[model samples]
Target: LWGIPLLHTEGDERTDVILGKFLKARDFKVSQALAMLKNCVLWRKSFKADEILDEELGADFDGMAFMFGEDKEGHPVCYNVFGVLQDKDLYSKVFGDDAARFLRWRVQLQEKGVKMLKLEPSTPNALLQVIDLKNAPWPAKKVRSVLLKAISLLQDNYPELVIKNVFINVPWYYSAVFSLLSPFLTQHQKNKFVVTRLGKSTEALFKLISPEKVPIQYGGLGRAGDDEFSGADAPVTELPIKAGEKKTVELAVTTGGSSITWDLVVVGSEVSYGAEFQPDQEGGYTTIIEKTKKISAQLEEPIRNSFKASEPGKVVLSIDNSLSKKKKSVVYRHIVKAA
Candidate 1:
């Protein structure tokens, strides 16, 4: 139902392993599994998890969360800035009481991690999520409410997908909040999670990821320039367009083989999206990707794509809304790196 092809669990030769997650979520009961599976699939369908891509859900929360690099086991490492999320203020602005929208964004991030793992077949079936709670402002009740929805979604549909959950720079009084969360976490999950303050010691983080792969914000060589995740709280671009109009967003790629990543969402029904590479050499333009779809008015979600340039040049992202007869606003998140 998610449109993802069936994937194996490595050493486990079970073809039904994907189905197993739903079954396990229902306690291995056949009828219960069916019911739960249907509901989960329906929920995802209505929420349009597949469409969120990596686009910014709101102007204020653009880079509050993102994927930096892989851990020692090659699992994708995701960082969540719990500090930037003022539950009432942020969530309200982004989701406006639509719980599914909030949950959908989180699920899409996990799916992006899974997609990354497919690049390294030898890697295990899991990802690492680091949430920093240094200066979170939400009250316990608001925090717990979001956690409840997260737990239900991750625990049920994406079982065993999160191998590590590192909570960093937790404030001294954070224990009170964690106590409420502990009941929902299984012993295995608890064992895989850690909460720590750097305090001149980043040993735990380095243990999971090589320093080179870690972001500079975390005392590592990884680069996240001007990103909100970089502790910089950088601003993201927002595009407004009319029907039959097109917009081009470009990023400079000075290093050969540097990667350019982009995320964009059409707030209305449908639009045309494409990506092209303009080489520094007097070479002609290359059409790396061309995709167009007309999703129902429900929401087209976000479209994400990336390509590694062979030489220094510019990567261009263009979206055409010529097919529609209405004005639309597109929020975009862009990242560049010489990977």
Candidate 2:
């Protein structure tokens, strides 16, 4: 299962590992685990889950779910953009008359995630899921029905394949819905869930994942089609801006003939941002790189800019959050490229 040899002839160790997963999922209840394993095997054969990976569900479901960068412990992260289903035309096409096709495609995505795992007892075998519910049809009858069925299948058949389920941009109504459903959930299942309200996604995600691995749409330093910086580049840094105060981050350019590139984002609210260069020598002039501009609260992407220097200096990036009463966190990273 999941590309791991399940046959007894394969190896006793592999079989034991597989059994251990089921056992752990059932809290070490041997009989319960065995029954669960039997059900999973039967379901796999009936559902053709192993072959779903070979099927192409096409681009219509592309925006629904996808595997992205890994989390802190190297568990692969899968992002589910529930908001994409808001498109009525596309929604009807995928989840319409019947949800079977949609369900199969969702399983395919899960299988892809499982393929990346070692499925061993020692390694990190589960996935980290980030479900963005912004503008999602949370209250829709069809949406609820489809998702509930999918969740049931995953919980029963997949069995502890997800390390964490982080739900971001959750609407206010969700709490009420969760309250109604919480009693039905096992404590173990409840423990794996994390909920973050709107405007707090970046802050919540940063706690579980590095900013560089997180996508920019979630207020991280990462950007799509980025050529200037890669995942293996310099580590991202975080600075906190106190309410009604300004904070400056300085990147010292010890040598001339180099270009400094930076990516920055202010979480939660609008802030005034600017950049400048101060030469090291006595009485050396300061050069303004970017004039102070107000970054709106709705900004979906991080600010990326570059500056070339001919003299030794320090590039200062300023974030002024004086207008807001709430403290904000800034995620940023910089690179010094030789000219």
Candidate 3:
């Protein structure tokens, strides 16, 4: 049940724990618990969940779900993208109509959390997950279907794998969906979910999680990968900068009116950042955007800007950390497109 290839239910302490939890979950009924466990094994086999950690099976979902730091309770932290799914149609197309593979992705994500937890001094029985729902509108039927499948699969088959489900900025429409999701959850699970209506409800989250482990974008100290967009051709570059440091990335604009699009995130602290346009002529560099704005220190909400060159020249996007004493890392991606 814990994704172990061959569960040694005979004398294996982990399997004993799983059996015990299932028994407890089902009112100490060995028959029901055993039934549940058997169903889980069968489901895993059919779903190809065991192979999810395998390279070929999991390659497509590598970055879709990621594991980072631990929660305040010392449980591994996982952030899933259910909340910010941009294109369900494209997503469905990429993964195809097979719910099994997608379900495998969910299992793989949780299993990845398990692998991370094993790195701790003492392995945790469960992991903490943050499901961001920002910009998540009620999507097409496919999206809803996938969400229901994921929730159901986790709640029923994977018991106590998630110590807590921290739902951030959940929309009002989600309450109805939660009502649907509730039946799938046991009372124990229902108790573990922490729902914050306002994304800015930092105080409540802090009560359970320490600031150091929370992402700065979410008003916490932890830094994590946020909404950074990179194309297959235009990959992102990572830059490290100390206080008072400056760095600029040069984008070649071969045609007049060519567009330069960029997204940058500074981890650990906010810094002044902007873009400059240098024309080919004696036109020198003109500050296209030179302003410092507050940004999250943990994760970044991509600060994106699209500026068209006035003439064939170089477009330089600069970051300045002169204002803060802490060092920070910047994740940046840029693309230059002809007008």
TM-score of each: 0.55, 0.93, 0.60
Off by over 4 Å in 2: 7-9, 12-14, 231-233
TM-score of 2: 0.93
lDDT of 3: 0.67
Model 3: residues >4 Å from true position, as ranges?
1-11, 57-63, 88-100, 118-123, 224-339
- Please give the lDDT score at residue 331 for candidate 2: 81
RMSD to truth, every model: 18.0, 2.0, 11.4
- Report the C-alpha lDDT of model 2 over 1-339, residue by residue, as the tens digit: 766676678774556677777888889999999899999999999999989989987777888887778898999999999898788877886667647888888899999998898777678888999999898875666666677788889888998889999999999987765775577667888899999999888889988988888887787776667767764467688888888999999998888999888888887688899999999998999999999999954687888888899999999999999988988878888888877
List residue ranges in candidate 1 displaced over 4 A: 1-17, 20-38, 54-59, 86-100, 119-122, 198-201, 225-339
lDDT of 2 at 320: 93
Which whole-number lDDT from 0 to 100 does residue 34 have in model 1? 78
lDDT of 1 by residue, 145-180 (tens): 777777777776666567778988777777777787
Give per-candidate clash totals: 2, 0, 1
Ranking by TM-score: 2, 3, 1
lDDT for 108 (candidate 2) = 92
- Scored by TM-score, the top model is 2
Candidate 1, backbone clash total: 2
